[model samples]
Target chain A: MKKALAMLLLVLVGTLLFMGIYAMEGFRPYGEVDLAQRVSQAYIDKDVTGENPEVVYGISKDLETGSANLVTSIIVNYRSFDTLGEVTVLFLSALGVSILFGSFKGRLRSRYQPNFILRTGSKVVFPLILIMGVYIFIHGHLSPGGGFPGGSMIASAILLMYLADEAFRIRIEGFKMTEGIAGSLYVLLGLVGLTLAGYFLSNFLNTGTVGALFSAGIIPVVYVLVGLKVGSELTGIITDFLKGEVE
Target chain B: MINPVLLIAIPLLLAFVSILYKGYRNNLLVFGALVNAGLVLTLGKGEYLIGGFKPPFGINLVLDDYAFLGLLVINGLFLLITLMSLDKIGENATVLLVALAGLNGLLLTGDLFNLFVFLEITAITAYILSASSRQYQHSFNYLVLGTLGSGLYLFGLILLYAVFGSLNMADLSLKMATADTSQLVIPSLLIFIGLGVEVKILPFNGWVRGVYGNSDSLVGPLFSAVYAGAMLLVFGRIFAQVIPLGAYLKTLLLLLGALTLIAGELAALSKTRIREILLYSSIGQSGLIVTLFLSGLVFPAVMQLFNNILSKAVLFTVAGQMADTTGTDDAEALQGAFARHKLAGVAFTIAGLSLIGMPLFYGFVSKINLLFGVFSLDNYWLPGVILLGTVIEGTYLIRLLVKLWMPGEEGLVSHESHATKAPLEIQRARVMGIVVLSAVLLVGGLMPGMIQNNLSESGRLLDETTPVYLFDLKGGQ
Candidate 1:
C-alpha cells in the first residue's frame, strides 16, 4: 500500500510539472515576465497610493512610501499588517519556547571552565555587536538589513555572552519587559494611525527625502519596535533554553 | 461601524500586553475575547482595507456575510470557551490571545498570502496548546504536520500570486475566471492537500488521533470547534467561491471527500476511546461538509459545518473532562460515568443526538438540507453512502451515549448502583457554557428558520443558492 501511494505521488508530481512547464500560459518563463505588469512595480516606484512614476533616492519629497529600500518599503509600508503578523509569528515561537521550559531552574551550567581570553573577548565584542544590530534596524528603511536580521544578531551577541561566561546571567524579566513593551508600542502605533488617519499602519509622519535617516514615515519606527521585540523575544527563548528544569 | 481589522488587532495588542503583565494574562485574555465578541456584533458587511490602500493593492478584511457569520460564531465560541475554562488557561493566556487574532484573520483576510500568515499563527498556537498536555510527543507530531501543511498552503498561494501577479482573493478569482482553469490544476490541488491536513480529510489527519486524544477539556473544545470551524469556513471560501476548478480536478476532489467521509465514519465506529471517536467523527463531518461545498451547495455546507463544530465542542469537552478526571477515556471504563453529572450528561446526550441528526436538533436541519442538496445534484450514490455513514454514526454514538447513561451487567437489570465508581465532576462554569451551547442547538433545531435566515444572508452575499428550509423554500429550485 505504501509503495502504491509513493507511486501515485510520483505520478502526480510528474504530471503537474509537465503541465506547469508546457501547458500553463500563466506560468511564463521567468525573465520573459514583465515586472511593469506586476504589482511589485508599484512598490518599487512607490506609486501604490499615488502616482510617483519615479522614486529618486534622496530626491523625491512627500511621496507615498519614503523607504529607499524597495523591499522595506513593501514589507514595512505597503503591507505592514502582514509584517506585524510575521513579528507575532516569531514572538509566538519564542513564547512557545518559554512556556514549554517554564518549569526549568536556573541557567544550564557547563562542565569546562572557559579561558580568560574567550570570556574577555565576548564581553569586548558584545557592545560592538549590539551597536551594529541597532544600526542595521535604524537604517532598515535606507538599507537592506531590517528588524529580523538585526534582532537575531543581537540575540547572537547574548548567546556569545552565555558561551563565554557561564555565570553571566542577564535578567530574563528585563528581556520579557522589553519584548512586551516593544510589541505593545508597535500595535499602539498602528492604532494611532487608525485613529488619526483612516487606516491602520498609515504613514502619518512627514516622509521626507527617500534616503534620509529620519524618512520613510512610520517605517523606521516600526522596524525599531520590531527589532527590539524580536531581540528581547529571542533573548527570552535563549534564557529559557539555558535554564535547566527543576523537578 | 466597527472596523473589522480591530477584531484581528485588539487580541494581538492584548497578547503583547499580556507578556508584560504576566500576572494579568488570564484577565487580559477574557477581556480580549469579550472585546472581540462585542466588536464582531457591531461590524457591518463590507471590505475593510488596511494601510488605507485600495483592494488588489493592499491587504483588506472581507466582512461579507460569510466572514461575518464566521466571526460571529467563532468569536462567540472563543468567548464562551475562555469563560468556560479560565482556570485551564494557566501560562497559556498569551497563546490564546494570539490564537483569537489568528483565527479572526483566517476568516476575514481577503488576501491569500495573508490567510497563510494567519494559518501559521493559529497552527503554532495549536501546537503550544497541545503541549499543555505535557504529552510532548503528540504535540511534536502535531507541530510537524501543521508546519508542513502551512508550508504547502504558502507554496500554492505563492504559485497563484506568481501566475496572476496579485494576491487579492477577488482579483485572483476574476483572473482565474478568464484563464484556463486546467492550468490551475496543480495550484488548486496543492492548496487542497495543504488545507486538507487542517480540515482533517482522511489521509492527511495522522495528528488528530494523538493531538485530540491527548488534549484536555480546555484545548479539546477550542481545537475541535473553534479552530476546526474556522478552517472549514476558509476551505469553503477558497474552494467553493474563490478558485475556479476544472471539471476533472473538481470531480477528483469530490471523490476524495466522499472517501474521507466513509473512511472517517468507519474509523470512528471502531474506536472505543471517547475523544478518539469524536475526533474521527469530526473528520467524517469535515469530509461531509467538504463534499457539500464542492458539490456547489454552499449554504448547506456552511450550515453543516456550523452544526458539526457546535456539537463537537460539547462532545469533546465532556470527553476531555472525563479523561482529565479519571485518567482514562475508555468507554467501558467510563460506563455510566455521567450519572453523577446529570447536567453534563444531558448536554452530552443533546450533543450526541444532534450529531446523529435526530429531529428537533440543529444537526437534523443541516442533515436534511445536506441530503436535499446532494439529491438535487442527482448524485444518488453519495447520498446512499452518507446514509450508511449516518447509520454507523448513529449506532456508535447511541451506543456510547447508552453506555455513559446506563451502566449495568450486559443483559441483566440495569441499576444506578452499577455506575462506575470513577469520580468525575464537571466545573460549574463549563457545565453552564455547554448548557448554553446545547440550548442554542435545541433552539436552532426547533426554529430552523432562525438558522436559515443567517444562511440566506451569506447566500445572498455569495450570490449562491439560497438555503432551503425544512420542507422546501423559494430558493430550492
Candidate 2:
C-alpha cells in the first residue's frame, strides 16, 4: 500500500509538472505537421517550381551529386561526418566484444557442423549476396542503400560461408588490413581536401554532370571507403563474437 | 572549413581500427590523443564553418578559448588516464577510447541535436564502463539514474527545438536573444535542469556518490576529469552564447551550485568509506566550480580557473587511487597509511590542502579568485557559503588523513589490498604518475602569474574578454 501510494504521488507530481510546463510553453506535439509540410514543400519546390525544368523540379538544387537520390546526398555529403561517427561506433562495439571475448588461438569454441542441404544452399547464395552488396555500394549515390546497409550485406556473405563449411574462417589479418587501409583512405581523402581546397573534407574538385555514375567528385570514393571499412569492421566483430569466451 | 568535426572523427577512426587490431590498443589510444591535441593546437581559434556553409545557415564548430581549454584539459587527462589504466583495464581499452571520442565530440560540436547524439554515445559508454563489474549493486543504480538523466536531457532538447526552428547553437543563441522572454524562460530551465543530471547539481545528483564509489578507481579519474570537465564547458558555452536569458540562467546555476555545495559537503562529512568520501568530495568540487563559473567569478579570469579545475581533477583521481591501494577507503581502517605509504600520504595531504583552499596551493588561489569574482558582483553570500563548504571539505579530508597516518591500534586491513596483490611495477608507476601530477599542481599554484601569461596569450586568440586560452588562428592581436 505504501509503495502504491508513493508511485501514485510520483505520477501526480509528474503530471502536475508536465501540465505546468505545457501551460507555460503552449505545448505542441513533435511538430510532425511542420516536418511533413517542409518535406512536401521540399519535394514540390524541387519538381514543379524549380528553375531547372529538365533535370526535375522542386527538389533542392544543391543535391545534384551524380545521384538523383536526396537521401544519398544527405548521407554521403551533407551529414557524412555523422555517418563516419556512426560507422566508427559500430567498429568500436565490435572491438569491445572481441576484446571481451576473443582468445589467443581463436579456438574457444568448436565449429558447428551443418547439414548438407543448408551447406549446399549457402554455397549457392554466397556469390549472389556478395554481388548484391557490391551493387548496393556502387549505386549508393543514386539509391537508398549506402555504406552501412551494403557493408552488412557483405558480412552476410561471409556469414554464409561460416554456415556452409565447418572449418572455414576468413583470415583475421586480412580483415584488419582491409579495415586499416579503408580507414586511412577515407582520412587521406579528407586530407586531400585540406591540401587542394584549403579545407578538410571539402568536395571542391568536380561537380561532374548530375545523374551520372561518376559524379559528386569524392562522394562515391568516400562511400566505397566507408563500405570497405564498415564491412571489414563488422566481419571482425562477428568473428570475435563467434570465437567464444576469452581464456 | 575544417570544423572541429575532426576531433570526433579522428578518435572514432582510431577506435574502429583498435578493435580490428586488438594488439595495438595502447598505441591507437596514444595516436588518437596526440592527433586530437595537435589538431586543437594547430586549428587556431574562431569558429570553423561546416560544409562551406555559413552559420545561421549551416552549423559551425566554435573553437574559442573556453572550448580550447576544455579540449586540452579533457583530452590531456584522457590520454593520461588511458595510459595509467592500460595494464589494469585490459580488453575494455577500446570502450574507453570510444568513450573519450564521444566526450571530445560532445565538447566540439555546435549543433544541439548532434550534441544529443554524442551525449547518448558518451552516456552509453559510461553505462558500459560503470557496469563492467557485476560485483557491485551500485552499477545498477548508476544505470537507472544515468538513463533517467539522459532521458531528461533528451526531453529538454526536444522542447528547446520546438521553441526555435533551428538547433544550431549560434542560431539558437540569436533566436533566444529575441524570442518571447516568458516562452523562452521555461525551456532554458528545462535544458539546464535536464543537463544538470550529468553536471551533478543539487536535486539531480543523487546517483553520483553510488555511481562513482562503485565504478573502477581508474574510471573515476576520467569521470571527474574529462567527462565532467567537458560537460561543464558545454554548459558554459550554452550560457555564454544564449544572452537575454544569461542572468536568469546564471541565477539558477548559482542557487543550484550553492545547494550542491552544502549537500555534497554534508554528505561527505557523514560518509565513513573512502569511496563515498571521494565521491561526495567530487560532487562538492563540481558544485564549487559551477558556482564560480555561474557567479561570473571565473569569467575574464577563466584561464586560471581552467588550470585550477585540471589540476584538481588530477589530484582527486590520484587520491582516489591511493585510497584504493591502501585496502580500505574507510577512515577508521586507513590508520597508519601515511606511515606505510609516505609518498602517497604526502600526495594526499597536498591534494587535501588544495581542496580546502590552503594558502600556496592551487585550490587556494583559484578559490580566492572565485571569491573576489563573486564579491565584485556584490553576491557576498555565495562566497561565504563556498567558504563554509570548503571548511567542511577540509574537516573530512583531514580527518581521513589523520586517521590513516596517525599512530593507532591494529585494525582490519581493507579487502582491496588482500584480494589480489597489485604488481609492484604497477604500484610504482601509479605512485610516479601521482607524484608528477601533484608536482604540476604545486607549480601551477605557486607561480600563477607565469601560467596566467601563457593562457592569456591563448585567450587573446579567441576573444579578449573570454579570458580562456587558445591558439590565435587569425593572429594574436
Candidate 3:
C-alpha cells in the first residue's frame, strides 16, 4: 500500500509539473509579438521573390551553371565532398568484410548446378540491367535515377552472374583498382575545383545549355564518378558476403 | 546538379557493393574510411535543396558549421575506430560498416522521419553486434532497454507529426516556436522521455552499464566514441533549433546530471569488475559534460565541455588497451602491472590523472573551467556535489593505481611473463598514436588559448554575432 501511494504521488507531481509548464507557455504572448517573429518573418518574406531570388540568379546566370535542378548543382558541384564521404563509407564496409571473411577457399557443396533454362535467362537479363544502369548514370542530371540507384543496378548484374554460373568468380583485384581509381578521380576533381573555382568543390567551369543532355557544368562528371565508385564498391561488398563463411 | 540526396545515396550504393567482396576485406575497410573522410573534409560550405525545392516547402540540407563539425568528428573517429577494430571484430565488419552508414545518415539527414529510419538501422546493427556473443547476459539486457527506448522515441515522433503535419526539422522548429504551447506540452514531454533513453539521463541510464559491460572491449569504445557522440550532437542541434523552453529544460538537465553523477560515482566505487568500473566512469563523465552544457555557461564553458569529451575518449581507449595487455581487467589481478609493462602503466597513469582533473592534463583545464562557470553562476550546491563526486572518483582510481604499482608480500600475481607481446610494429603504431594524442591534450592544457580560439570559432559557427564568452548574459538569458 505504501509503495503504491508513493508511485501515485510521483505520477501526480510529474503531471502537475508538466501542466504548469504548458500553462506558462499558454499565458505567453503569441503571433506578431512572439520572440521568434523576426526569423520567421525573414523566412516568410523570402518567398515574395521565390526564395532568395538574387542568390538563385547568381547561381544560374552569373555562375553559368545551366542545370535546371539546382539541388543537383549544389550537391555534385558545390558540396561534392559530402557525396565523396558517402562513397567512402561503402568502400570501407566492403573492405572490412572482405578482410574478415576472405580466407575461405572451399569447393562447391551444391549437389547440382543451375539448369540450362535458368542460366540462359540470367545471361539474357544481364546485358539489359547493365545498359539500364549506364542510362541512369548518364541521365542523372535530368531524371530521378542517380549514382546510388544506378550503382545498385550494376551490382545486380554481377549478382546475376553468381546465380547463373557455379564457377563464376568476380575479379577482386580489378574491382579494387576501379574503386581506388574512381575515389582518386573524385578527390582530383575537387582539387581541380580549388584551382579553377574559389573553393575546394566550387563549380566555376562552363555551364552548358540548360535542360539539355550535356548541360550542368560538373554535375554529369560528378555523377559519372560517383556511379563508377558506387558500382565497383557495391559489387565488391556483395561478392565478399556471398563467398560464404571461413573457418 | 548536386543534391543532398546524394549523401544518402552514395553510402547505400557502397553498402550494396560491400555484400559482394568475397575476400580482401581490409582493403575495402580502408578504402571506405578514406573516401568518407575525404568527402566530409571537402564538403564545401553551402546548403543543398532537396529535389530543387526551397525551404518551408521543399527540404533543405544545411551544410553549416554544426553539420560540418559533426561530420568531421563522426567520420574522423569512425575511420580510426574501424582501423582499430580490424583484427578484433573480423567477419562482422560489414555489419559494423552498415551501422556506421546509418549513424552518418542520422546526423546528416534533415527529415525527422528519415532520422527515425536511420536510427532504426543503427539500433538494429548495434543489437546484432551486442548479441553476437551468445554467452553474454548483458547483451540481452541491452536489447530489452534499447528496444524500449526506440519504441518511445518513435512514439514521440508520431505524436509530433500528428500535431505539426510536417516531418522536417527546420519546419518543426519554426512551427514549434509559434504553435499553441498547450498543444505541444504532451508531444514535448514525450520527445524528452524518448531521447532520454539515448542521453542516458537518470532513470533512463539503467541499461547503459549492462550494455557496456557485456559487449566486446572494442565495441564498447566505438559505442562511446561514435554512437554516444553522434546522439549528443543530435540533442544539441534539436535543443538549439526546436526547443523554445530553454531555461526550464536546462534546469531539468542540470538536476538530472547532478543526480546521475552522484549515483555513477557511488556505483563505480563498489564495482569489483574492470569493465563495470569503466562503464560507471563513462556514465559519470557523460553526466558531468551534460551538466556543464545545460548550466548555460555560454561559449568558453561549452568549449571546455567539448574538450572534456575528447580527452575522456582518449582515456577510455587507453584504459581498454591496458586491459587488453594485462589479460585481467580486475584491479586486484592487475596489481604490480606497472613495474612490468612500464609504457602501458605510464599511459594508464596519465589517463587516470587526466580523468581526475590533475592540473597539467587536458581534464584539469576543462574541470577548472566548468567549476569556474558554475561558481560564477552562484550555483553553490551543484558545484559542491560535483567536487565531492570528483573526490570519490579520485579515491577509487588512486586505489587501483596503488594496487598496480606498490610492492608488497602476496601482491597481485605477475602476468607479464605469460602475456604474448603484440606485434612490434603494431605496438609502435599504437604508442605513437597515444603519444601524439596525449601531447595535444598536454599542450591544450598548458596553453588554454589554442582551445579557446577553436571554441570561439565553433561558437561563431553556432551563432554568428554572438560572443562566445562564458559570462555573456545578453542573448543567453
- Note the DockQ of each predicted structure: 0.73, 0.19, 0.06
Tens digits of per-residue lDDT for model 1, B1-477: 778889988999999998888889899999999999999888866667788887677998887667877899999999998899888888999999999999999999989988989999999999999999988998888889888888888878878877889988887887788898877887898899899999998778999988998888999999999999999999988888788879899888988998888899999999999998998898888888898878778778877888888899899888988898899998988888887889999999999999989998998998898888888786768888789889989989998999898998667777887789988878999999999999999999999997677556454333232121111122232
Comparing 2 and 3 on TM-score, the stronger one: 2
- RMSD for each model, in Å, please? 3.2, 5.9, 8.6
DockQ of 2: 0.19
1 against 3, candidate with superior TM-score:
1
Clashing pairs in 1: A104-A245
Error of 3 at B23 (Å): 15
Residue A85 miss distance in model 2 (angstroms):
2.0
Worst 10 residues of 2 chain B by lDDT: B468-477
Model 3 spans > 4 angstroms off? A1-82, A106-113, A245-247, B1-243, B246-259, B298-318, B341-347, B358-365, B375-388, B407-477
lDDT (Cα, tens digit) per residue for candidate 2, span B254-325: 888888888899999999886788778777877777776565444533443354355555555554565555
Candidate 3 residues B1-477, lDDT tens each?
Answer: 333334444444444454455375456656766677777766655555533334434444565555666677677767766665456665665666566667777677666655666666676666656655443466656667766777767766766665565666766776777876555655555566656667676778777876776545456667766777776656555554455444555567678888888888888899866567767877776667566656654333334444544544554555555556554456555556557556655666666677788888777877777777777786768889889889988988777666666644334554445333332122544454455556666776788777656634644332332211112322221
Flag the better candidate by lDDT, 2 or 3: 2
Q: In model 1, state the lDDT of residue B270.
A: 95
lDDT against the true structure, per candidate, is 0.87, 0.66, 0.62
List model 2 lDDT by residue over A1-247, tens digit each.
Answer: 9999989998996886677577655346654446432223333233311344444423324432434666766565555555655655565555545554554444344455688998889888998998898778877877778777888899988977775677677887888788777876776666677567655566665746666777766888888888887888888877776774444
TM-scores, all candidates, are 0.95, 0.80, 0.65
